[model samples]
Target: MPGLDYFSFAEMWSPLFLVFMLLIATLYAFVVGPWRQRFGGVEAVPVVRQLAFYGAMLLLYLVHGGPLSLLGHLMFTFHMTDMAISYIIVPPLLLYGIPGWLWKWAFGRAFWKPFRLFANPLFGLFAFNLLFSFYHMPDVHDWVMTHYVIHGFFYALLLVVALLNWWHVMCPVPEWSRVTSLRKLGYIFANGLLLTPACVLIIFAPEPLFAVYNDPQVWVQAMGYCVSGDPARLLEQFEGPAFFNLMSGREDQQLGGIVMKLLQEFVNIWALYSVFMQWYRKEKSQEDDPAFDHAASGRLNNV
Candidate 1:
């Protein structure tokens, strides 16, 4: 119910409290559930990993979505970068690193049917991409940037798509659905390819695209009043009010794009390696076993 703003986020009730809730939920899931069962009765992820991950995510929210978000509202480059990474990269990695069962228990039942539909290969991939692309269009992007509810919904939808996309590549339930190692590798690379054009456009575009990028009032509305210069001066250099000249925006947006692409490549390489090793081992085992085909056939039919 609290709004998204610098003081609001810094005030302990907004992002800080939201982060605490996330920690509590994660702790409960790991400690009371999987971690408890897995490690004899004790429950704790390696303290270092959990702490580091949460710390980074918290800092990121503070920097990008908090005070910095205000500055970005004035600057086209910063805003673009903020939207790209906050929506595309950070959430998925954070979610993926989380123990799978915890997420399953949290959103598993209530959102199960929709989650599955979204996770479906055909439905999930294209729909999220379409929506993501459309949301970034100038008018729609400006609208979402201007409205609180729309912004929150856009971020939430992006996270859902991220979850589904990752699930297809790293499935926890093999019985429900699965892709071969080669296929998983292929899927990741394909994702990389699909997201590439947008990154290129953002990085290489000759000038700003959205109205918020050029107008001060719109930029302020989009970013929440965090700019560094006189509103008039900032508007003078550019045709409009976009934090048009800030290196921060250029650095942030470009780096975010690079990070997204690189992160995808890293995960994909790992997945490819894993799949290849698994398949090679499986194939070798079959070669040594005379009854492998019959056993495989039986398993296939059961599925």
Candidate 2:
């Protein structure tokens, strides 16, 4: 296998981003531990929640600033895998990991009220899917990839919308949950359905849709964001992204789409099972309650 050892350590590991992630993790530990009293935390956070938060941070670092990030630049498959992990997988983990008290403390301020509209189920549903699909459009993708500022901004926007979209399903704060358990199932289904068209376009296209992957010149230009040294040297040393890719452009593109779709389905299935079980358990608990039974009988007798 072609190894990434050829690349500089900075390019492969992104030391700056690594430091940023570590700082954030350290800050989180403090905020949830020593600083919890200042934040009005009533009790210690669960160990499982702490683990999930750290796990989310680790995954984020691996995909964005680790070897996988470098691989993503060289191959369409890894790029799509990065996308799946970033938007689909990471958001839920973050939502589940963070404590409800922290969520309230952070967003409970009056200034944040205006942004609450983003939490609307309908807005969350369409905004993320629309932006996600729009981003994958060939021209848009190429333009964004080539422009560093726009690339960073757009990705940040995607992360925000992804967190918003997932908020309905994860609902870290029980009181803040907008969608019912039954509706959350529908939300997951709608998410899978909305993302299908984009995946289909990538999977079934006769030719590779992205110039950055197929054209050496464009590929090298995009490399500027990930590679530290002069971009010109990249073409001289490695020739192009093709030097690193093992499959044909079309095959890589198809495989990327397939991988993304499969991962989405897998996450959605787990979400469905979770929501269904929650609903089932709630109903069962209600059934076993004498008060609930009496209320049910009273309502039925009145009807």
Off by over 4 Å in 1: 1-60, 63-77, 80-84, 91-95, 103-115, 225-244, 247-303
Give per-residue CA lDDT, model 1, range 202-282, as digits (tens).
Answer: 666665566676656676565443433443443344443422353444454465456555655665676678667876897
Candidate 1 positional error at 51, Å: 5.8
lDDT accuracy of residue 123 in candidate 1: 63
Instruction: Give one digit per residue, the lDDT tens place, for model 2 in 172-263.
Output: 88989888888899999999999999999999999999998998899888989887767868777776888888899999999999999999
Candidate 1 weakest lDDT stretch, 10 residues: 1-10
RMSD of 1: 6.4
* Clashing pairs in model 1, backbone N/Cα/C closer than 3 A: 74-243, 75-243, 78-249, 214-241
Worst 10 residues of 2 by lDDT: 294-303
Q: What is the TM-score of each candidate against the true structure?
A: 0.67, 0.95
lDDT of 1 at 256: 46
